[model samples]
Target: MTEEPVGTLAGIARHAFPKAPMEVLDHVDVSVEAGLAGDFRGAVKPGGRGRRQVTLIERGDWEAAMAELGHAIPWQERRANLLIDGLDLPQVAGTLIGIGAQVVLEITVECDPCSRMETIATGLKAALTPDWRGGACSRVRRGGRIALGDDVVILDPLQGQLL
Candidate 1:
């Protein structure tokens, strides 16, 4: 028998720049707990076999992460490939992030951090905000893959609650 995940899709990558190269992502990972991420892959680029990873942005770490890339890009100004505003990964593992008439996803395993984040956003270790900053990444369990301009909707919340 298998168990189900919890939580819902609060928000998705507010902005997605599919055209941008992997240099944009400082770090990527998967998370399980409520406030902390689980595992991470760091950068999002070429060279992954079957294990894909999710990118993450620490609170104040965004600035430093951007700097390491030799660009003055601001954190808020960045267009992440996939943005999740709220909702815990572990809590909402089975939930789906619904977009208008297109893609949806079931919460898979928690995404943890990889090497890129350690190098770029070292400050992230100390700057993680509970409510703000940024949420973690997720694997697309169902529906089509997400593209730009897709609207996200949370299918559930903590304890099957809806907001």
Candidate 2:
């Protein structure tokens, strides 16, 4: 069988937490401003309505690997589903990219992980530590709907415009 040709940036993995599935969203709305992903009073999941939890991306995380491994070697933070490779997104996490028909978000900020992942990854901390070093996070820019097989198209990459 012929493999489907992925466009410019490869869409490696598509993921959603057990509590929050992509289907819960209708269209991801990424805000180009005002987003946070670290521990704060208003950043917990089971908190009251005004605040939410901040997301994370480890350097060698499995989620980063599933996105793309073509560049920057295999650091844990690189295993994200929507690999916005080559873009320095320090202040742009709350934005949105329309992936094919759906919108894959870039909403989280970096939050370093502690010992919990060691249990989830089954004692792979030594191999995964480097990946977690470069952490990541995201917020629901616009929550509506998303799913697997959705194509990812970077609205604006790190290097300005594509040649």
Candidate 3:
């Protein structure tokens, strides 16, 4: 199958609070069981099924969202695990994205902005509404360490099939 287009991992952020400032990190560990190391979402669920092991946002989308709001806002305020560049983060579910050398994430759903966003900035929630601006929630498939500047690759299931 043909390989999907490549992108870049621009940044990484995580926080312990549901509505607190995200702490940017140079590198973070990702695993099927715990998600990002120390990330709040890593807490085990009773059934061992958590779709939000990690979250990712496209830098382009973030910039567009900010421009639509008429100002710049910190990336941390979005509360995503990774900020990616040069990829159009498909809104479709079941998409698989490979981060760095070993981490693989299956896109589960759109990460809708919550009321907490409004707390981060006025009009923030509304600003993040269109074009999957808020980002995507994913579950870790294959776990590994991810760092800034890692290669982001999309894995299209229909790669070699005739449409």
Candidate 4:
């Protein structure tokens, strides 16, 4: 029998420039050389394919943070490239996140909230902290088209699933 997906890609977003408002998309292109299409970070970065290529946040965690702050801000304010639901992202470095059947990402580090977060709301940066509420930073290992509702999976690197 086929295994059930752990979660679905709940949201997709991109930005035209740094510190610019995030533009939510129904679908996007992922690249090994340039992270997410239309995202300035991917094209502006010096080199192709490294940590911070993509940023993802858990839908539940974002809502919890918002609730704690008593603000009904949109998730796009998080400035994350993707939003996922149903799975808690692993904190361990080297964990793999698979999108759909082709795109893969290697978790590199915690995506810490910056001072900009505080500008959005008082204590937003703090609310996004404590147990990785800021989401995850990852490098694109494999690239392809990714769309909302695509299957998301956490893969075991040791099982020869690195591809």
Candidate 5:
């Protein structure tokens, strides 16, 4: 019944292909079928059925991890699609996040820290291990063209609260 203005979309990025350099976007056309326009993952799953269509990371959490590591790594290295700020993201799956005015994403799973994270720093993976600091994976439920700083709301907080 209560919707929370959880955060704001701070950044957006996409990669053309596996291991490709991430391209920072000022605005992106989100699609239920393609996730972010020109994103490689979208091309792999054209039907819009992939649960990991989009990935999100909390800016606060990312900062915390970087602080612990005593380094200033950019959020892009985490390889998430959207960077959010304000409140912590829900650790559980099934929560719905509404972005801007039209884009909606259903959380599907934890964006677990991968081995590549260790390549960035000695303890980077562990720094992002506790909580969902590594971010989350989701499936797009609604589509829209969104830009940085768009309002983000927690539309289904009841499904999962911050862990």
Candidate 6:
């Protein structure tokens, strides 16, 4: 079979509170048990405790969503843990993606926008609704430190292969 294209991890961010602003970071430690180190979600919810152990979104998709809303907004406003480039994040549930050398994540569901998005900007929630623009909720599978510029691989579970 033909090889699948690889993407890149362009950015990372985390927050200390549920509604706190996101703080962008250069790197983060991910684990099957801790999700992202120092993240509030990790501390409060713990890894393997919830489907949203990690959240991922595509930079392109974020931009598109902003354009649809007629403005440009910081990606951190979306509150995703990782920002990816050059990959169309799968909206389908159960899609597995590998970040960097380690850190395998299984996409559990579409991260639908919450009222907080509407609070970020009027019409933001509606803008993020179409095309899975709100990003995806994921659970950590294999853990490791993920950094900016790390390679992203799409793993095909059906074939037990990495693309």
Backbone clashes for every candidate come to: 28, 39, 0, 0, 0, 0
> Global lDDT of each model?
0.37, 0.36, 0.85, 0.88, 0.85, 0.85
Q: Cα lDDT for residue 28, model 2? A: 33
Candidate number with the higher TM-score (1 or 2): 1
For model 1, the superposed segments whose C-alpha errors exceed 4 Å read: 1-80, 85-91, 128-134, 156-163
lDDT of 5 by residue, 110-153 (tens): 99999898987999999998888899999888889989999877
Error of 2 at 112 (Å): 2.8
**RMSD in Å for candidate 5, one decimal?**
3.4
- Residue 6 lDDT in model 6? 89
Over all chains combined, what TM-score does candidate 6 have?
Answer: 0.91
Task: Give the backbone clash total of model 1.
Answer: 28
Model 3 scores a C-alpha lDDT of 0.85
Evaluated against the true structure, the overall lDDT of model 4 is 0.88
* TM-score-superior candidate, 3 or 4: 4
User: After best superposition, candidate 4 residue 160: deviation in angstroms?
Assistant: 4.5
Looking at candidate 1, the ten consecutive residues that score lowest on lDDT are 30-39
TM-score of each: 0.41, 0.38, 0.90, 0.92, 0.89, 0.91
Ten residues in sequence with the least summed lDDT for candidate 6: 41-50
User: 53-160, model 2: which lDDT tens digit per residue?
Assistant: 323332224444333332333322233333333233343454434444533445445544455544434443444445333445554333333333455343443542
- Native-vs-model 5 lDDT? 0.85
Which structure is stronger by TM-score: 1 or 6?
A: 6
Model 6 spans with C-alpha error above 4 angstroms: 1-3, 43-49, 158-160
